[model samples]
Target: MLLNQFLVLGAALFAFGVYGLLVRRNVVLILLSVELMLNAVNINLIAFESYLVSAQAVGQVFAIFVITVAAAEVGIGLAIVLMIFRNRKSANVDDLSLMRW
Candidate 1:
């Protein structure tokens, strides 16, 4: 019962995150959406880790690693976004075509 509820909530969060990522133009908003998705994944991993009494802490370790990677992604991503905005005066992904070869 509890797991079902958690799964539903996680699905909802992931859906919203995808929506935000697809629909938002602001770089900050996109970062926030990615964070939401990461959080949803973390919730599932923790829930499963708790449910499974196995000695293996694979899920917990994976969740922690995901958090670390997400943190680095956000930091680097935001920095790049800021630099692009500074150079082009726009944060819209659609407007970043000039940066690519």
Candidate 2:
């Protein structure tokens, strides 16, 4: 209910996302981690807008934009992952490096 509570939740979500991003080897998990990070950002933005600037909807608008971008990112990321899986026979992050060679 409080701004601090929302911020704490956002921080926790972001921390989990960061950990997942660093530890996960699968491309799909990495994408989910990114989505989690984006959701955390949205939580922060909405909380700030509601508490700090109640009259303005800028934060809400920005959160909507972020959601839109996240959707597009997921679409593109999944497409790329599918392509990688098709070409490399695996969707692990390490396999992506082999593309360079």
Candidate 3:
């Protein structure tokens, strides 16, 4: 119920997401971690919106925009990952070197 509680939860989620992003080797896991981070941000935005009691619901609107962007990101990211996997037969981030000349 408290704003601090929501903030703490959001921070914890964000930290976990960052850890996953940095430590994971699988591309899918990294994408999931990014989603987690985005969800944490959504939580914070809604929490702030509720706490501030604004008439326009700006935080919720922004969160919706973020969700939309994140969806598009995941779609594009997975498509690329799928193509990479098809070509390389692996999804590990360390194995990717398509950008190198």
Top candidate when judged by TM-score against the true structure: 3
State the displacement of the C-alpha of residue 5, model 2, in Å, after optimal TM-score superposition. 0.7
Tens-place lDDT digits, model 2, residues 41-86: 9999999998978666999999999999999999999999999899
Q: Write the per-residue lDDT of candidate 3 for residues 5-93, one digit (tens) a residue.
A: 99999999999999999999999999999999999999999999999978999999999999999999999999999999999999999
- TM-score, one value per model: 0.89, 0.92, 0.94
Instruction: Indicate the worst ten consecutive residues by lDDT in candidate 1.
Output: 45-54
Deviation (Å) of 84 in candidate 3: 0.5
State in Å the error of residue 33, model 1: 0.3
Model 1 residue 55 CA deviation (Å) reads 0.9
- Number of the predicted model whose lDDT against the real structure is largest: 3
lDDT of 1 by residue, 1-101 (tens): 57778878888999999999999988899999999999999989887887784598988999999999999999999999989999999998888787488
Give candidate 1's error at residue 1 in angstroms: 5.4
The candidate 2 region of ten consecutive residues with least summed lDDT is 92-101
What lDDT score is found at residue 51 in candidate 3?
94
Residue 19, candidate 1: alpha-carbon lDDT:
99
